[model samples]
Target chain A: MSASGYVQHYSAKVSDIYFIRPIKMFKSRFKFAQTKVAVGALLLLSCLPFAATAASLEAQLSQYAATAKAANPGFAGFSAARGEALHTRNFASGKPDTPACTSCHGKDPRSAGQTLTGKRIEAVALSVSPSRYADPAKVEKWFKRNCNEVIGRECTAQEKGDWLTFVGSR
Target chain B: MKFPTRPVSLGLLVLAFSALVFSRAQAGGGHYYPPVVDPVVKEECGSCHLAFPAAMLPAASWKRMMGELENHFGDNAAVDPALARKITAYLVANAGDAAGQRYSAKLLRGVDAASAPQRITALPQWVREHRKVPDWEWRHKDVRSKANCTACHADAELGYYED
Candidate 1:
């Protein structure tokens, strides 16, 4: 055979080995691993983003709880029941139009709500909206705005923890 | 054969001029205000309601609104001073009276520059355009507020307000 022909034959073989072998191997590997383990692995992989978000929210709540505990020696642990009451309680001291958190957030936190301007608010329940309270800053911003509008004052650390616990528990 | 250059050229020129005038009229008339483009502006202002187009108000109005965010329409919407400044800059730069915003000229037609109107719904042209909408429609559950432009417009968020 000519030298050029041999070179071309070697290059073709090299290309086939490099390109086709890996794809064939991958297919075979995938087929072999198509079992309960694969399904479990896939499920775990798909759940990662939600897990991260939930963890961050949990960490934020714990941080708030710790702060509340330190702020007052008499402070007890947060109660989801108290949080539910806080969520539904109406105060006349704040804006009359928005005397209760439920005025905008709706009576059921699991259901979607509407703003005074007719904008749709997403459900606040952790089960309904898993992405809720992921960002500490965003959570703080809303708490500041809504607490002032509904209660006419900034919510205490305990109130925030209790509300978050209530929403998450739901 | 003669090409008839003069008449053809004149006809073409007339067609081009008319197209330009028609387009300008469409832009100036009640089409749609351009939607908010800045991410910071969209995030901060859009949380509660649709982030209103800055072109709907004058620079002075946006400045005043940013300055009084603590009492914004009877709600405390105050942001960090630095973020507020950035948002104010974005709104002012694209305000009705801002340069290259000829489309807002009609919206600001009867608006007194000195008054610095805060509500876009309160603008003379806005009120005139919406005069036909009945009182019941305004009070309807779906159409609770004039600020809810998307309630009727459907594509208000995408910057098309054609009825």
Candidate 2:
């Protein structure tokens, strides 16, 4: 953030503080005796939105818990290592029509190339911003699309998790 | 001897003043609706994206984005009506608080006035430090953009260093 941006952010905070003060006062006045009840109700209401996010984060964590092993506990880096491996590992169908992930993705995930097949082989896992792959939905869409093209199957969450763990760790 | 109510009145006045300040502060982004996150949002949405740390955007941004799912960035990442309701509920629950800030992907995408690339990204001291690198090095199609510090910088996620 720039000096000007910082100043603006500060002003915005000051302005917000100025605003919420009145509402709190009014709430306290008529509801002084019922303050506990009122605050409890409001807190309950306030917490509703976060429930799903909490659930989502929990579910994701649980999934990780389920498959933290075999995938390699030391796969500690971003899931990019798996994604990198997946990118280069050639599938052995009757013959080796397609090469491994690295065959076209290049040895370095930071830099890869296209194949004769016209697929836009990009870096195994980009962590830059504007990030090349940050949207979870887009990641799923591609996984659905690419897994079929490359490995002829849908990637398991464990696989995706491993890939993300590796890539994000990077 | 009975004490006078002067101190009580003073406390009331102090409380009133503080309430006034608090209400004003709560006026903007703090006016959240509710989070509608659900199984669909968790599974389908979380597939490629960051599951959007709830506090990342103000309620207004979430409302705006949710209301327009059909054209969500040229894609329809919508779910069944019930699931949509659930997802919206989840998002509103964790929406941005005034003190914590509500940054959105769109906001972070460098489109908003505050996050615009030239103003925010390019002017960033870290970016400036790296800006010295020759265009050839950063723009190589191998990765494509010079802004991708993760290309060479190992811990781009932790923090941005001098260009």
Return the TM-score for candidate 2, rounded to 2 decimals: 0.28
Can you list the residue pairs that collide in candidate 1? Answer: none
Q: Pick by TM-score: which candidate is best? A: 1
Per-residue accuracy of model 2 over A42-94 as CA lDDT, tens digit each = 99876654454344534553565466654666645335466556655777631
> What value does the interface RMSD of model 2 take?
8.7
Error of 2 at B81 (Å): 16
Q: How well does candidate 2 score on lDDT at residue A160?
A: 68
| Cα lDDT of model 2 by residue, B11-93, tens digit | 99999999988865554323222222455665644542324444545455566667776555433455557767777776656
- The lowest-lDDT stretch of 10 consecutive residues in candidate 2 chain A is A125-134
lDDT of 1 by residue, B32-108 (tens): 68999999899899878999988889999999999999889888899999999899999999998999986577789
**Sliding window of 10 residues with minimal summed lDDT for model 2 chain B:** B111-120
TM-scores of all models? Answer: 0.81, 0.28
- DockQ in order: 0.72, 0.02
Candidate 2, superposed: residue stretches over 4 Å from native: A1-83, A93-97, A115-122, B1-163
